[model samples]
Target: MPKADAESPQAPVDPRLLRYASASRGFFVAIAAIALAQTVVIVAFAWLLTRAITSAIDGMPVAELAPTLGWLAAVVAVRAALLWAREAVAARAAARVQTQLRSALVAAVGALGPEWLAARGSASLAITAGRGLDALEAYFGRYLPQLVQTVVATPLILVVMWWQDWISGLTVLLTLPLIPVFMVLIGLATRSVQQRQWQTLQHLASRFADTVQGLSTLKVFGRQHRAAASVERVTDQYRRETMRVLRVSFLSGFTLEFLASISVAIVAVSIGFRLIDGALTLAVGLFVLLLAPEAYLPLRQVGVQFHAAAEGVAATEDVFAVLDAARASKGSAAGSADSHSPVPEPHPAVPELVEGRLVVRDLRVHRGGGMLPPLSFSARPGTVTLLEGPSGAGKSSVFAALRGAAAFDGTAELGGADVRALAPSQWLAWAGQQPGLLAGTIAGNVTLGDPAPDTAAVSRALDLACAQALDPALELGVQGAGLSGGQAQRVAVARAIYRHLRGLAPVVALDEPSSALDAQTEARLWRGIRSLADEGATVLLISHRTSARAIADTVVHLEPSEVPA
Candidate 1:
């Protein structure tokens, strides 16, 4: 029942939406055509009903009025059919737009990479892509169609009424402004409250997702109940906001309906007086009276549907914000987040996957509003560069910078070309501290991103990763849950090794690759890593174990950010 406001900033039909979701362009045209037909059907039904009534009043036989009555029935059926068609079209268009927006959103996130997502929490983005986009059903299926009807039907109906009887039309014209006036006034208030509701819902979703993801840690700390209570408080706040929105919606609906009814009543009374005074004929008076309600109906319905689509409208704003950011960041390579300097794309002069020699010059990683310790090293093909550092000595941060997971200052070059100019997948195969894996067969996980995977290479990579005993065909649950900590870590390293074996990546970087392994297994892993380097693949190994220094051609030690290098 909330008043629909075209003037409200949040109520704008963002032009970006049309540009992004091309499916909606044709939908508007289809809805306009249906609305025009419905407008015609409405006039025909009203005129025919007037004819039938006048004929009966004039003492015409039932046989003569049959044609008028039959035509009126046909008009009603056609109008109903058009309504059904609009609904079907709206539903289809909503689905297509939702899909298009969601796909674009995901692609944009990927283009931005983890750096941006790290700042903009993935949980909220998930909500925006999932349920937030889903809310477009009401926006497209109900609110948008009603808006089209208001635009196409209202003016046309008013024109017909004015043409039939100028007095009634003038009265309607004077009173019609009241609805939108009130709508705008009410919308100004509703806009902020509705936005609050949407934001609170997102906050609630994020909190709940965070709680679920860290439930075990919370229980261990004996703070699980506190976390649950915090979630409940957010839930209650959301509920209160929702009820407040409902109250405003109900009040707005009643106000618009009251104004529309009053306007119609005024027109009706005027028509009645004219009929009594012999100033208007039975047909004209009846036609004008019948058209009065039709003039206001479309606009009233638009306001009612606006409230229904409020959530969707808010969601679209969030979606558009992300799309806009992505568009603004277009052409900025993933690795260029730290600098505004121009980034050159991979040029033909530089051979793909050439040499895989890594040269780091005065590299400093940016983390948590501060810079990490400076690091510099050169790792060449056929050699292992053992990077030894304490826990917070920026070892993992260096890998993050090389992989475009964080912003950094200074230069990292692979094969004499700036690493920022090239994608990580082009030259670097990496396994980090976390065994990031998806639900899939072991073979599938190992061969990810390789269109044509070699089963022989998969076995070789697993053997090198010390995961040869793990069945290639074994299936994994979410986040590779079927495997133990050590097993999953080995599988992740195997995946990286598989990429290197396939010749897709020339450098294999391991971040504490054997962190979960026993001493015996760790030694085997070190041997495998050393062997890979001997085979002419550049390798960078970050390990806390001093024993790793034995395999190194170059051992680079790092200090903390606060300490002297």
Candidate 2:
């Protein structure tokens, strides 16, 4: 399940939103200032139009009326300019906020590491970081400004209305609450449905991405048609959820419109009767009547904009949850540091185990809320230590624990330091079961993370990894698509070798590096692994092939362990 799968419709503006995306804070202040100016302009425009109309009716000379008319026109233009300014500010602010939130989200995910992300599908996260943040434009640009307008304009308009005509002011005051009452009721329904709609969209994206990624396997098993049907089903469900959101939005719009119209009508009718009965002056009556709709307008709009912003609000909940998690993780680390807490080792080590040796004693790695059975081994400088095991025997889990992706109990030390105390990049040059290659020249891929890549060393690393046939200049597509699996695997090994040989890392850990190679290539790769050990580099090799035994200086076999219930 998603972490922030629920929606909160209560707060008009989430405080956490401003905290995580600091770009939006100044935007609110700017929008508030603009809203204040707009409220003043709205009143000026109404008063000038009233003055111009009353003067013309009294048959005032054309020359005298010209000034009022000119002022009215000027006020109209200023109001138009203010609207343009608000939109410009909102657009720019929205863009800045989106960029900030996306950056924070990506960094947070990196800090959390791949082990935390394994439970969350990449498709859902992509949607959140991409389309999810994009929807904030409506919230930041349109809905938020209108909401501020409502906050600043509505009450001020009502106070002006009361000064001019108390009866009309009171009439508006009585009916205005109806709109929000309906809004609250309708917003409750909209929040639930919009949340579901957002979740369904995530589900659809995950379904489509999963199908495309595994299309080859589906075809091999003759289940491609079934996978297509599953994607279509999810797509249809998303469409239905979208339609439901639209219906609620339309309903909310109709409700607010109906209530606002009726409220304005009530105020208008009362004003007209007062004028006919000689209870009100013409100037005041006209001014308050014009001001009546303006008073209710912002509230009605607030109700409407609330629905428009609902989806964005939902997205923010998820974005904020991720950010909050990052903050908590940082705080925990800080707390641990203050309390003199580093990852503790389970036993008092033999003093001789301090330097150069990669030693593990009774290490149990975490696996989905359970622990793998304890195992222990060591690899010294200039030796290939093989971790051999069957499927589900926790071989890769051991590598994961070393790299900070999985938590483990017990001690693993290298070069006189705890593995947990050092950054993985400082000590381990690792390649996992997956090639994990990005789109780039093979040279760039091999020399990844190197500040100044050595051209000569790139070639040597390729040769050492038995990837000499692959050119350094060869370019590949996303995930190294141009190369065959064996070629990509060799390139991954070369990356580890390049890092190690450059003295950038100490332990070269390879997981199933020859899984895709033929017997001939496998033999050559084995020679390269042996050569690295011969050069006084510590090599941790994980492979199932019995052929791996010939090169191993020490073989530690992992026994099959069942996942705990």
Candidate 3:
């Protein structure tokens, strides 16, 4: 994954987000239609209002000017309505884009798996996918539409100005370049500042989230104060960073507004000179002045909104970088031909291994700066196998390798074919060292992502994992917070068992399955686990406890491998 760095302020628009934006073409099309109608109304309103006012100044009778006044009123009313419709369209587009981008971001992160997510820090990812994407609302709703307006409206108004009087048009043309030049200079200077602000935001979010998640542990160890102090420090830093971004924002907005106001002033001065010399009529001078500000308005709004959108842009860059990393890692693992495919098909299934033994021959996993000594073992059908090892022995590494969560060298076979060649969905059900439960009902955790979760199967798995003690309807806090350690582990085990019971997979792997259980609960859990083996499913457990050996059909003891100099 890409490490946090000061991203270039001038980084190009992310193609991923652009692709998502493109998918909402209908929304933009509606917006464009409205903008076009609104632009025409604005120009007409200016011309009609000018004509009526000039006639009034010339002492035209009220009765005679009534028709012109009525036309102006009608134009103003249509312009107001179109303006409302344009805003409504922009809001709808913003919402659609935000929802689509957030969903895609989350799905991509999930497909990358736990190992990749952990490396990036979950809190940071959460904030990016949640709040960071939300910032795009300002971009989509305000900045982007105005940008389109500047493209469409500015030129149309400028042509009208030039047609009215060549002198006023010449003055506007000379000053128009100044607004963009100032905007560009200010953007270049503040891009890095905004990038840094976003990085600090992610860091603060990561620290705060980790602290909250581990609050109980910190309180038990009487270090909560220290954690609080650290949080406060980070929070202060974030505040300062936020202020810096605000300062830049205020500066940019002021600069763009000031430049635009001066440009309008210059146009006003030329129009006034022409009017005094009788070279221009009162109506024409007033029309040119009104249109002058309109021409610069869109460009000025773009500059202002661009600063607001900078943080979202930075977050977007980070999200795409993570996605790119995931793609690269997957590509490397699958090799060239099937590399880009997220999931490749296993080699044609061997019928003999379809429901047979899992065999390993010198299966060495590369991890922690060294290779684990070649492991040779066989897990027969209808047997429970325990992998016993000291801390740092690469036991979990080996387990992950067999499950295809990590890459390894040497052969691992089921029946007679290599394990890597077998479809993992056909055989593997894994419960990690910690219970990875979302905040939901116990039943929901047991059947996460199951299309049609069966209550009977859930109850059976709960009983088998000794987790029936937990009420099926009980709600767990985030990360299974409300449950005790043992209960949480049991719930995780139940999840694997639920999958097994549902016939999704036949082999179950539990990492430190009973580490939090008391002797009695541990025994009951293992007995339940062992029963699976007796019922013709392969069971693999990783543990360091000596008591686990008593129930295991085979115990393989491994010592930590030494790192080579």
Per-model CA lDDT versus the true structure: 0.86, 0.86, 0.79
Which residue pairs collide, candidate 3?
none
> Whose lDDT is higher: candidate 1's or candidate 3's?
1
Q: Candidate 2 residues 1-565, lDDT tens each?
A: 2445344446888898788888888998999999999999999989998888888889999999988888888988999999999999999999999999999999999876666777687888889889888989899878899989999999999999988888888898889889889988998898888888989888899998778767767998999999999988988988998899899999899989988998888888888898899999889999998998898888888878887777888887788888888888778877887788766432333232212888899899988878998888888989999999788888999999988788889999886678876667777899988888889999999999999999988999999888898889998998888998889999999999999888877789999999999999999999999998999889999999999999999999876654344
Q: Return the TM-score for each candidate structure.
A: 0.90, 0.94, 0.91
> Tens digits of per-residue lDDT for model 1 on 223-307?
9999999999999999999998899999999999999999999999999998999999989999889889999998888888888
Q: Against the true structure, candidate 1 has what lDDT? A: 0.86
Weakest 10 consecutive residues of candidate 3 by summed lDDT: 4-13
Give the Å error, residue 557, model 2.
0.6
Say which candidate scores most in lDDT: 2
Clashing pairs in 1: none
After superposition, the stretches of candidate 1 with alpha carbons farther than 4 Å from their true spots are: 1-8, 331-342, 346-350, 561-565
Ranking by lDDT: 2, 1, 3
